[model samples]
Target: MRAGWTWLAAPELWPGRRTAGEVVLALVLGIMAAGSEELLGGEGPRLAVVGIAAVVLSLLRRRMPGTVLAVTAALTPLLSGFAPLLMLVGWSAGRRIVGAGRALAMFSVAFVLFAGVTLQDSWSQQAPMTRLLLTTLYFLATTVVPGLASRYWTQRRTLLHALQERNAQLLWERELVAGQARLRERQRIAQDMHDSLGHQLALISVHTGALEVDPELTPRQREAVGVLRGASVTAMHELREVVGILRDGVEAPAPVDDSGLVGRGTAGIVGLVESARTAGNTVELRSAGEERPLAAAADHAAYRIVQEALTNAYKHAPGASISVELRYEPDSFVVEIVSAAAPAPAPGEVVSGGQGLTGLRERARLVGGMVHAGPADGGGFRVAGVLPYGVVEAAPFVAAEDDFRQQSPKAATVNGLPPMDWTVSARELAGGKERSRAGGIAMGCGIGVALVLVLVVAGGFALAFLVGSMSQGMIDPGEYESVKIGSGEDVVRDRLPNGDTITLMGLDGKGPKEPEGSECLVLMSSDVGDSFETEPVFRFCFKGGKLIEKKSYEVSR
Candidate 1:
């Protein structure tokens, strides 16, 4: 019972401001229909009753569109004045009904009822065959054609909305994938730093500690050694804090062996060059400008950039001569590595993941710098990086995690690890494409349906006009003049044409009043052509079986 009440109180069915507006429109239409009926010598009150009843039923059209359409169609033939209400309900039914089969069934029932009533009325009045055909065409134009148009329009709007929503969802998913990729990259960088830099600092602390206890060391020198040991330990501690920030809550995996290629700043680069020379590689290191201390991140980034470039040179151009240059500008530090032309690698001799250069760029960017790498002037590759002197703090892991949670709560992992795959799902792409295709089909179908409806209505009106013109009742002026005012009804009837032009033309009340206590007959003048201009009409009134009055007048066609 509660559910039933809720259903009844739905906004579409319940009376509110919209209902009030509908009522006002209905009342105005009813008054106009009633006035037309009274002018045409019909019962105005009867037409007004039909109009009011149809409007009342129409109020539920949104909730019970099929029922409303049926009721309105059944009432249409009682008075043609209610036909507009029937058309409105038909359109509402089309928009609200979900499936084509259901709509077809509902509209078919309405058409049958409307046609039956119209045919019955015409048969009772002995209407011509053309009148029956025209009535059927009128029913199609007012109800079925308009209903199809409304259905097409509603479907087009719904499809467009669906497509828009799908496009927005796809865009959001793409952004999420990119964010996850960046988070994963940051974790990788933190792991690399922990393995290489932390290891180097620990070694420094061990070496300094051993030197401080040497038997031959002077007191001041030993004190200096102790300070160096303390500084190394502090650097290691700071490196750990930075790694923690980059790692967020996720523990990085154990690091692989780095093959002893670890150091810091200019000292590290010199050691790296010596190691390369000891490995039987042609290598040179040049430095210029006054050396100055670099920010922690920039120092580490510079070391990694050279390490990666040397690794690439060893792998891709095993025998190429490599030159490493370092420049200290006023505001920045520059590292450039160039390898001379070398023969192409033998098949399977060298394998590259292609992430080395990308990592170089990412490292430089994190330190407020940029990297450029491409083929050198001759053949071998070149990699260069510009790193700023001032420290650029790494992004806060806690804030990033919170932002990720806010943007995509479902994407969070209990282990705090980003998912491996950051590419958009194939299914989502397919779904978007399918929606676009459906929208296109719907648009094409709507345009086709509209064109067909226009053609059908235009053809129907043309046919009706041709039939009406041919069936019009017309009499020659000589025959009308020969019939005196006092002639018998049969005599006047024999002189007239066998049709009622006034009824067919719908010009019943647009003329002078008839004589009192008499029956009247109206016909068209034969001399007047059927066109959009004035035409002469003849009216004859009879009393007591004899013609008492006859008159002629002109009315616009």
Candidate 2:
């Protein structure tokens, strides 16, 4: 029961389940339609069929709007009294369809059907001229008005959805920029700490080893120096591990040695392949073309690219065979690393933090390079990067290093050092052009306002004309003029349009009650020149169903 209620509340939960709002609307419309049927003395099975169809159509209005409208229009003539339900269908169509041309077509088809039904019914009771006028008015009321209102709402809804999506996209872009800035800051800190602290630790280890070999020291003192040298060497390795964590925000399978503390240089690629082989993975390295010289930044980026790829293979494919290839061209250096797929992970194996590939991409992008990583052919993954030769000249790095050297000794401390500007420059470089759409917005609003004004003016004039025509239809001026005193009841009814007679006791507010046994019929008519203005009235008294006295005079407002 709970699941049923949940499905009813959310139509999106499952297909074909009616929403609470739709069920309520359908129920209300069905009941009102049944009332219309009974009012028209439609108590048979035909009315039942129409009522059932209307309810079912209303329930499916959002899903199949055009089909429901077409079926409703076809049934309108036989069930003309069910006009309210049909108008609701027209409203739904207006709100759902987007284009004005399509909406107009739908309204036109419904109008034609409604006019046919109205004309057939009025034909027997009304004159040829009167039937046409009534059919047009009924058509406007049943189809045009409701559909136009729905179209207006549909336009507003579409605009609102677009604005919301744009706003969300802007928010996402802002967060992405902020996150990139933070990651860059972490990388700069890691670089500075590795340079300063690692140098000091290496100096301490070297001096302690020198003291252990000195003949001037006692035997016990020499033993203490040996312990000190071993501890300092261990501390240096641990510090490199910390730097790697700071660079990528994740524990890596291999510690990064990009700081040059290990003296790998351009030959670092060989050591990386050896390390991968040592980690129980089969490794192969291939090189093409002659080796070429590169700037410090480009050299480091190339080395880091190979290092990160090998590290990823170790983490994600532990026992897989790997191939590392480096191609040297006239103006570019390309590296590709491919690894075979490993067995499925064990049940409780440690999961990756997913930052390695992102760091590699950012690293390449900083030096005007690109990296691509994805599944390779035949059940393995491939990581590749292309670094343009001479992309980062020595000038920028040399200038930054010179400025750092100029700072005071105390200011070299990481906490005391000024914030770097290279990051800010990189951010500005990555930010693309931004353009404003104000001109288009202004033009769109102007066009929208003009259309609304046109519709309003047109609707106003149409309503005025229809009201004027219908009012004029009620009282025929020619018939009123033809009625004479002493005319019989049949003559009076024949002169009038609907056989409606208003009994009056006066003419121009001055006469006796019932016209002294000759009942007086007062007929009023509106001036056709203006919609709100009324014209003069005529009174004719009848005796024994025959008119006896007649008078004509204007009635004041």
Model 2 residue pairs with clashes:
486-547, 541-548
Model 2, span 71-123: residue lDDT tens:
68767767764677777777777776557787777667766766675566453
Let me know the TM-score candidate 1 reaches against the reference structure.
0.49
The local distance difference test score of each candidate is 0.71, 0.65
Query: Per-residue lDDT for 307-383 in model 1, tens only?
Result: 88988888878777899999998978899999987665634658889898898877777677888999999688898
* Shift of residue 194 alpha carbon in model 2, Å: 3.2
lDDT of 2 at 182: 76
For model 2, how many clashes?
A: 2
Give the number of the best model, judged by TM-score.
Answer: 1
Query: lDDT for model 1, on a 0 to 1 scale?
Result: 0.71
| RMSD in order of candidates | 12.1, 22.2
Model 2 misplacement above 4 A: 1-28, 59-64, 74-80, 120-189, 218-235, 251-557
Q: Which residue ranges in model 1 land beyond 4 Å of their true spot?
A: 1-48, 124-129, 168-189, 212-231, 249-460, 467-557
